[model samples]
Target: MGLRSLQGRSGLVTGAGRGIGREIALGLAAEGMNLALLGRHSATLTETLHACVRHGVKCVALAADVAHPGQVKAAVDSVRRDLGGIDLLVNNAGQVDRAEVPLWEADQAQWWQVVETNLRGPFNLLHSVLPGMVERGSGRVVNLNSGFALRPDGRYTAYATSKAALLRLSDNLAETLRPHGVTILDISPGAVATEMTANMPMFADMVHWGSIPYLVATVVDAARGRLDPLHGRFLHLGRDDLEALLRDAELIRERDARTLRLRPYGDEDPLAAYS
Candidate 1:
């Protein structure tokens, strides 16, 4: 389980102010990794920072909105200056749509805002963080993906669409960064109970909500390069069998599974990558 020598590795996690981000940050710290925490809430970031500090790992908390490219650049610069360099990047900041309405009936501004946060936020972080990782020839990026990305849903069009786009981005980045020794992974944390989900009416009848410890550990493994064989893949903590995925990575790649891809009409299709 302890596949990494993380005593001096530095990482930055967005949305580290609360929820699963805070938990993952704390888990990383416990594994002896130094961290820079980014979020819009200064107070919550401080609270997380304080907790991580108790683990005796170097930690910094910065208040910044992930949706803004300018803020992301500035925050990443500070992370570089303070942490020496980033070995891991976790794009976890995201927002969900409030209403379960059809796209035609959705609030335009709110719809776009969810896209800005869920998709553009990750893009902003990757834009700012990739240069350094590429230059250094080592880094891992974990995007907080969702089940919505893999399925078509009538409700929360913005959330589903944005997550789907993020998954595609992760796949593209993984291929583009392979030669540079950087890896990008997409993982859904599953139905973890949180303030955000508790408010969503979609789960009103949900009998079971899962824990995030497994998700956090999987991320840690990804950060450690233990899961590099499955890079460019999408994993769901609630649904995926990690051991099987790791063991059958060759089969997974041979079939091009666990990735977002367009289905070809037939073997004669001209645009199909598989063809």
Candidate 2:
């Protein structure tokens, strides 16, 4: 499925210099979505821009850390100035340095840092981009999440908790934006071969079930409204229930009940009961 229908759309992807973010940017470019790519590494960021151009989509590479409020504002403003208002925003920037650290030994400082990046980072981007999107009355927001958000496997406190909050954040944003035609989705990809996972201790433990492109496709699908069933819901990407899950309109509608309440992010335990 070529996403040529997405040709005229424009988007901003965080952490897009390498790994999954890089693949996502390229995938969007292939569909003709112009990109405003953001990352910390200047060299890798430039490489993403070139890759987007190779796919023949307009591209702008912005070097900025997603965790920095000032940098996030500046980068988003620059994207608006350069590529027009973004029609899509991919909150792909995340960190899990302490995933293996025991909760008792977790550094509070490090935990806060990861929380700021994994959760607050997306919140900031969505906050900055949302008003314009709401005023425009249409847009898409894809918040990258992890399966651990729902099924934590110990030693993943910071990562899992942040992502859990992120999933709820996506739901909250979606409900508020829905009446205005802005769709928000939480999509969790299975293990992929990325720098973040490359040499991690648990890397070999999990199945290399898929690739970065699978996650990218979910973003593209959400952008095109093909993923409406998963909007405002936590969608696990690598399940035997993939097809049924995607097609389960009733399941989606049930989720809408929870999404409509406009609950605060991080209160997912209440919603989980409904699930």
Candidate 3:
């Protein structure tokens, strides 16, 4: 579908107050999609909402902590009441531990906080939105994932574990949701220049940065169902070639590539066999 096909579609984006979330919200708005922006801070969300409105599409801002079920429900309900049922959902709100310490050295509270925000946040939003999408029989979901999900990162245990689990969540849901005409994609935006990355000491002197435009374009394409054949797969904007991937969509589906799975010890491996 062309970008114009997105016009009049309704979407809800978490963490729409700033950074990549803000960019995604504006990009969707540019496609003429109505937006419901959810963020922890009203001030920043208002800024994004105003910018999106300039695109001549309907926009609303709601302050809600994505980790809180009550807040997410209320926020989603308001979006349905105002902009209509959400056709797209972006799980963009995430958090990292304040300190980049190993699991044993990490503060308990801070570690759990990161886990809850990154993992539970998406769970809450999905729980609140999936029923409506299933009832409608058509919807798209994009979960902002990371390389840490595929590779083991001991330094940021909580963040890495949360993201890894989220990728699995996307994969598991895809199998069930596909028959309902819903698509779920786990997209890794990579190491983009964002407030979250800047604050991490590990990336203090990082030179190379991922392209935000590429990431946003990938997201838009996924939202438009351009990559539906590869649904429930992990996509890395920095490393994976989108055009090439699209061309190889059939092979990807046949081989179940780009998904997190247990490496089979041999051809007889039960897990791999089942897959």
Candidate 4:
């Protein structure tokens, strides 16, 4: 789709100071959407704005730690005031505990920091944005989840657990907001080369099998509303397995609904428990 289509649209991108968030912000700006960029590092956010200004879209860089509810609300409010109402919200801020710590041995501060950033950050942003979006009767919410959300490995308790919770939040929020013409999507961009993963011991190996550009393209499509089925579900970028993703989401929804539907029956009909 042509970028001009989004000329008047407004978007807020968290973590726009670097990496995947920066890329998403640039992509949206390229589509002519005015941007509200959020990050803790002022210099990095400013760099992101400069990089995106070429798209001829208005860009405002705001420094705020998204994990803090107060800061999140203040920053989002400012964005709404400065850039007009937000038509789309990209929840991309996240953190991971040091790579070497075992789950049981993880420091309390490190663990909480990861949870606050990866989980609480989005919750705070969503809490702030959804009310306005709901009142407006239309909006798009994109969550930057991780592959770990689905297939968690050991030694990643903080990151994995928070991401898993985020997926649940996304699924519930999608259903809750869909009636208002709001869509919530959780995007797992596979592996990417970013500051988050740069210092990792397995960085090179992860990148060898990761698909960065594919993930970015998928986000672009999502912003343009071209990605179907995956709109209310999780996406594994660069794989192009939309059919599989859709199928899995459907299966999950069906399973959940079935469980709920059967719960009442279980108490009334002993035979129902067998099924």
Winning model by lDDT: 3
Model 1: per-residue lDDT, tens digit, 6-118?
Answer: 78999999999999999999889888899999999999999999999888889999999999999999999999999988999999998998899999999999999999999
Worst 10 residues of 3 by lDDT: 1-10
Provide the global lDDT of candidate 4 against the true structure.
0.80
Worst 10 residues of 1 by lDDT: 1-10
Residue pairs clashing in model 4 are none
Q: What is the TM-score of each candidate against the true structure?
A: 0.95, 0.88, 0.95, 0.87
Clash pairs for candidate 3: none
- Name the TM-score of candidate 2: 0.88
- Candidate 4's residue-wise lDDT over 151-261, tens digit each? 656768898899988988886676778678887788888777788887666564663656666766667677666654444677667464765655675665655431112
Where in model 3 is the C-alpha error above 4 Å?
1-5, 267-275
lDDT for every model?
0.91, 0.81, 0.91, 0.80
Query: Model 2, residue 211: what's the lDDT?
Result: 58
Instruction: List residue ranges in candidate 2 displaced over 4 A.
Output: 1-3, 205-207, 240-242, 255-275
Question: Tens digits of per-residue lDDT for model 2 on 1-275?
Answer: 25576888899999998888888888888888889998889899998898789877889999888888888999899999988988999999988855587777888889888899999999889888998899998888888888778766668788888988887777656667778888787777877777787666887777655656778877777877787656577676766355777777676676464232434456566664454
Count of clashing pairs, candidate 2: 0
Ordered list by TM-score, greatest first? 3, 1, 2, 4
